[model samples]
Structures are given as structure tokens and as C-alpha cells.
Target: MDAFICAGMMIIGRGISRGCIGARTTCLPGWAGVASSRRRNRHRVESSARRPFGKRLERFGVEQGMALIKDEAVVLRRLDFSESSQVLAVFTRAHGQQRVIAKGVKRATRQRASVGIDLLERGDIVFSQRPGGEERLSPLTEWRQLDHYPHLRADLARYYAGLYAGEAVAMLTEAHDPHVGLFDGLRKYLADLSSDEPGLLLARFLWLLLTEIGLQPELSVCTSCRRLVTEDRVLYFSSRSGGAICRDCEPASIEKFQLSVGATKITRGGPTDARGVRAALTMLDYHITEILGRPLRAARSMHATVVKSVSGGG
Candidate 1:
């Protein structure tokens, strides 16, 4: 009789666990988890990690859990989860881009978030990968805010622009891809966009992004013939063709955007042609949007919010 009851309870408990506990944790959330099978695998990893559990995970290169060390990082973005905890997108100066799950960050504000949960937040972060877990990207074991750049959040336009910059970085940048110049440009542009003129700052940022990605226009001379871009009657831009086309090279696909001789003189922006930054920005904008097939929301937002985008420089 005793054995029968124990066996019955085991069967019933297994059924209940399968029916209830099995649903929410269908998969482990990692790398933007959105599938059922991945979620189920996540569930198995989490449920089996207990005292009685005996299976050992494969100790592959990333398996020794060396990935779970305290790292200094900059907060990129944060998203609230459906239940508890917060999802964090971070860029580490040391390791590059990664996702850190800051568990138990939903109900109460997390102390660790003060370190790198928002714009310009930087600090020491504790991260780890568990053998089996119900979440993707692994739960962040610990975190504490070290520093925050107040300038990033002080201005709305600058703040939004920072987000736009972050998105651009997120979309184009591959995981673990490290380019020191791009990061530096982002930091400087974020800090400067607040106190600096909108057009000039945006122009500089786009130019840097283009140059960093090696997509920058061939403006030093005629893109086709390498002849110096002298005062020409009209200028045409085509996404399929790339950059300003000479009169002979202009294709039917290329639509003309009027460029002033003043605007055309803008080869680069530093000390020399500081006055023509806006012109350069407009030129860059035409090229970027022409290629991307859409205008940057931040740029359009600036035009709407400022009431007047005074003609001059970025």
C-alpha cells in the first residue's frame, strides 16, 4: 500500500509539473529568444541544476564559465521583461557588445542598475554563464553602478540622439567586433551633441559612422574620374551608383539635390571649414538617406523640435 501511494504520487506530480511548471519556461531566453524549442531547452537547463542532479555539462572553451567574470561596461539599452528582472544590452570596452540579464530588477529598482542601466552609466559588472538556465544570455550574477555621464541625460535631443547612435551601433556592429575609433567617436559625439549645435554634431557623427564603416563618399574628387569637384552646374546623388556623380556619370536613377559652391567646398570638418558643417551634414544626409531608404528619425525630430534649423553649421 505504501509503495502504491508513493508511485501514484510520483506519477501525479510529474503530470502536474509537466502541465504547469513546463509552460512558462518553454525555452531559455538567449540571443533574442523567440522560439518554443529554445525555451524548452532553457527549461531543462534550469530544472536539472540541483543537488541531486548528476549530469555534467560539456566543458567547452566557453564552458569553464570564464565568461562569467567581473567586467567593466557601458550601458547601451534596457528592456523590461514580462515577469521579473530587466534585459540589458551593454557595450564593454574590454569584451565588446553583450547581453546581460539583470534578474530581480522589475519590482524594485536594482542597485546594480545604478552602475550601467541607463545612458552613459558605466561601472564594474558581475556576469556569469550557468550550465543550465531558463533564460538566454545568462542571468547577470551581480552588478553595481560605477559612474554616469549626467550630460547624456540632461538634454532631450542629445539623449535621443545617443539612443539613435546606440541603435545604429547595435544594428550594424557584429557581436565582439571592436573598433576603438567608433567607440571614441560615439563617446565624444554623445558628450558633445548636448552642448554643441545639433546640425554640426549630427553631421560629424554621420561622417564618422560612414568613414568607420568604409561607406563614406568619395568627395575628395570626382567619384568617377577623380577630377576635382569644381563649381559644377548641378550635382546628382544615386544610392545604386554611390556618392556625387559627375555630369557624365549621372544615371537616370540618380536624382539631383542642389549643392551650393559653398556647400561643395566642404571636404572635411575640423578648424578650417567649421562654418560649413551644416552644409556638409545636409550633403551627408542626402547620401545616407538615399542609401538607407529612410531619413534618420533623430534628424527629422531635431528639425521639428528646434522650431528653426538656422542655416549655417552643425
Candidate 2:
């Protein structure tokens, strides 16, 4: 009996010691656990510190009720907002057209002159916007200039053409509606503007923009009667009628422009020459003007400059 009681007491003591150890482990982790937790937290801090600005903002923006966006963009327009700030209309490849205000972008310092953001410059941009405030302007947090297209600045004709392209994008596209093809085409056009014939390049870009936005005018058939248009017949393009109109349909179209065989052929994927390209460009410009209910300002300036250049050469 004495031996059995001693054995029971030993078992009870073991249970009590284990209970205390388990409670301590559960309720209060010791120095090792605390050190391990500290190490994990430090790792997280270092990882976050090494992240890019946009990524860091993305994480913080989620908690702060804002969205962070990063994209390649071209500055279409710029307006001075204050002594040290400016407002811009930028067309981004992924996010479409955005109006953003750049705070303190024009502030002069000892290191650099405050020229501010210029119109028609391409760059990589980082910006932020509120979740429900899309209509309001976004804040442009960071801008790294990619290409200024200095050649365009040197030539009056090229500069006006660039302005025309930028203005068209600003007017035709809706905000926040992405057009990746159009953005790519614009970049290509601007890059080639220094070498390629300005009129031809502009015409191609305009057609691309029109097609991207689903406003391309039909060129193969009579828009009114849906009759197949033969190559030899006279063709008139009517923006209101939505494409090429036959002689019979021409009178009914309130707005019509006569198209030469060469112009029609060029517009229909045929070989292009100087005169044909100009004709096609004029037709497209007319259609765009009708759609916008006003003449494009840059286009008008560009045409005048072209005419003067021609006359002066002559």
C-alpha cells in the first residue's frame, strides 16, 4: 500500500509540472519565440523597403482608399495651374486618357531649371486616384521622361503635325477607355515623323485612330444603297452617309466630298503616292471635323504651314 501511494503521488506531480509547462508555452512564448517573431517582422520591413514606389503605394493605397496606377503615357495637353504646379491631359497605353495635376513640377531649384512638363512628350508615369472619384482629376505622383522627340521641336511642320495628332486623341477618345493599338500607332507615328513624309505618316495615323475607335468610313460599297462600287465610276464620300456614295446617292447626302480614283484606291489598301495621300487625308479630316462640329485647330495651322512651304519653294 505504501509503494502504490508513492507511485500515485509521483504521477500526479508529473501531471502538474506538465500542465504548468503547457500553460506557459500557450499563454506566454519565451525569449526564443519573441526573438523569432522580431526577426520575421524585421524581414517584412526590409522587404517592403526594397519594393518599388508603385508597389509600395499599391499596398498602402489599399488601406488608404486610393488606387495606384503605373503606365507609359504621352502628354497631350498641359495647363498651368499655379506657380509651381500644372494640369495635364495624358494618354496612357494601359489606362487610356487621364487628366492629372502635377504638383510642384514647375518649382525651380539650384539643381535644375523649372521648365515644367511640355506638351507632346512621352514618359512613364505613376499616379493615384480615389476609388469612386474617377471623374475628378488624378494626382501625378511621379514622371520619368522617356522621349521628348526633339526633332519635332526643330521643324515647324513636324511640331504642328504632332500637335494635331495629340489634339485628335484628346478629342476623340473617352476618358479611361484604353486603346492599346491606337497608343502604339501614335508612338510609331511620332518616331517616324522625323524621317517619313509628314503628310503620309499623319494620314496613316488618322486612319488607324479612326479604325480603332470604330469610326472608319466604308470605302468599298455605296453606303446608302449597299451596292458594290466599281473602280471606274465616280465616287463621293459622305461622312453623314457613313461611306462612299454613288452618283445616285450623292445628291441626297448633305455633306459630300468628291473622291478621285487614285484617292479611293489609296484609301482601299492600294499603293500610295503624294497627291493621293493628301486627298485621303483631307477627306478624313473633313469627316472628323463634321463629327466634332468644328475644325481641328492644329490641323488648320498645319495646312496653312504646308501651303506656305509649298509656295515658298515654288
Candidate 3:
């Protein structure tokens, strides 16, 4: 009894010796039970904290054993990364703009059915991104070519136009936000670039992109006063006002381009000759430059390749 008291192992009132509930007894299981209760409480709090995000993760298509994401993407730019890898900036149909590092795609021995992740190629890509909210580069595991525009690659004019489209899409769209219609429009435009008039096609592409993003100018009316534009007097294409302005609504302080009668008719989807097409292209370019805050690099190249060719041929 003295040894038990010295050991401080005996309960004074809760239990007696020899496992009876009375004074001068020891009980070890009660101590273990208190520790177990603390552990259980801690686990419950942690599990509750994780429940919401876990459900969201499931909604984002994270399966039980898989973390891969799949999407169709158009390659806009490619950069060499080590000896056997390449990093790509692509506009995806499902994920918008994404930067994915394609591992081992640069190696000569890596065989796949795709066009090898070159610039301006549309393909299916499977990738796994990092878990955090910050922008992290993902690993591209598989690539299979879907639409390869060989003609655009072969022609410098068409290639630059396609690059301009890709750049606009990448710059205007937000990451991981799907824009299916825009993706389809770009795919169709690139496909038709080789056979169509390159200058007109590019101008149309810019128009489509601007319209889809809600930035296209008010073509049939005065942007300043919302008046229906008519061929009544000399009109001005106002870059500052974002549309054609009637004579009364034109501001003296703002610089404006004179709208040809033909250009005015073209805005209403009327019959347009070659001159009207040029005028429309010029108006669209000014508006696009206003939105982008700078001239496109490909636009300069296209001036020589597509614009000059159209002018020279006409």
C-alpha cells in the first residue's frame, strides 16, 4: 500500500485496490479514455473542415484514383525546356488559356499520333495541374492531333493571320473559363484561311473575335447618339466613340476617319466592292488597336503579306 501511494498510481476516492470502485485503488483505463476522446475530437474537426472542398473537387471531375484533366487545345506558342521537353501556351476549348509542359515531346524517340505539339496545331491534351489556386504549370501526359492546318503552315500570309487569331484568343480570354463558341469560330476561321482571301478572312476573324467578346463597334448606328446611320451627309468613323458618328454627333476634339459612302453601305451588310472591303478592314483595325492598346506584331507582317498583296492585285 505504501509503494502504491509513493508511485502515485492509486486513486484516493474513485476505486479501491484489486479493481474495485472504492478508495485506495488504481484505474489506468480512464486515463487512456481521456486521451482517446481528445484524439477523436481533433479528427472530427479536421474532417469537417475538409468536407466542402472535397465535394467541390469531386464536382471538378477528380475521380477516386485519377487526377487527370482532359481538353482540346490549340497550340499558340511552344518553348524548349531541357533536352527532351517543351512548354506550350495553348487556348483550350474547356480550360481557356493554359500553360502546359509537355514532357518528352521534344525527344526524337517519343512517338505519338499527334503533330508533335508544334505551333498552330489543334489537338487533344491530357494534363494534371498543381493543387493550389495559384497559376502553376501542368504536366501534359498525352497529345493526339485533331486538326492540323498544313496549308497555313506552308503559307506565310495565312500563318501570320492564324497567329494573330491565336494571340487575340489567348489575350482576351481568362484561364479555365470555357468559351466553346469562340473556340469553334477560331477553328473554322483557320481552316478557311488558305482557300479564302487572306486579308478579308483575317479582318472577318478580328470582327468575329471582337463581336464574341462584346467589343465590336456599333456598325449600323451612331455610337454617340444611337441614331440609325444613313448615307445622308459625310460620316466619320470615330475610334474614341467606338462606332460611326453622324455629322451632328461628331466631336471637334477627337480625331476621326472619314467614312466612304461605300464603307457606310458595307457596315449595313450591303454589297461591297474591293474598296469597301479595304475601308472596313481599316476601321476594324483601328477599333482592335484601341481595345488591345497596341498594334499586333502579326498585323505588321500581314500588312506586307496580305494587305499589300490585296492592294497590288486589285
Task: Please name the candidate that would achieve the greatest TM-score relative to the true structure.
Answer: 2
Report the C-alpha lDDT of model 2 over 1-314, residue by residue, as the tens digit: 00000111122223222123221121111112212232446565445446553444442222245666889999998999999778999999999999997766676544345677789888878777888788988877567678888889888878888898899999999999999999999999899988866766777788889889999888888999999887689899888888899999899887898986555654555326655666676787888998899988887886765423331222
Expressed as tens digits, the lDDT of each residue in 1-314 for candidate 3 is: 10011001122112122223223222222222212232445564345335653342333223233346778888877788866667888888877888877654544321112223578888777766655632777766456567778888788878887887787777777777767888888888889986987767767777777777877777688888888877667788877677788888786628677886556544354324566556666677667777778876676776667665554334
Per-residue lDDT of candidate 1, residues 197-271 (tens digit): 655566667677777777777665656665666654565544455566666666544465655444555445632
Off by over 4 Å in 3: 1-66, 110-116, 231-233, 253-255, 260-272, 311-314
List the pairs of residues colliding in candidate 2. Answer: none
Instruction: Write the number of the candidate with greater lDDT, choosing between 1 and 3.
Output: 3
Instruction: Give the 10-residue window scoring lowest on summed lDDT in candidate 1.
Output: 1-10
* Worst 10-residue lDDT window, candidate 3: 1-10
310, model 2: CA deviation in Å? 8.2
lDDT of each prediction vs. the true structure?
A: 0.52, 0.71, 0.63
Query: Which residues of candidate 2, in runs, are more than 4 Å off?
Result: 1-63, 269-271, 306-314
Q: Model 1, stretches more than 4 Å misplaced?
A: 1-66, 69-72, 109-116, 129-138, 142-147, 231-233, 251-256, 260-266, 270-275, 290-299, 306-314
Residue 33 displacement (Å), model 3: 50
- The TM-scores, one per candidate, come to 0.63, 0.76, 0.70
**Clashes per candidate, residues 3 or more apart or on different chains:** 11, 0, 2
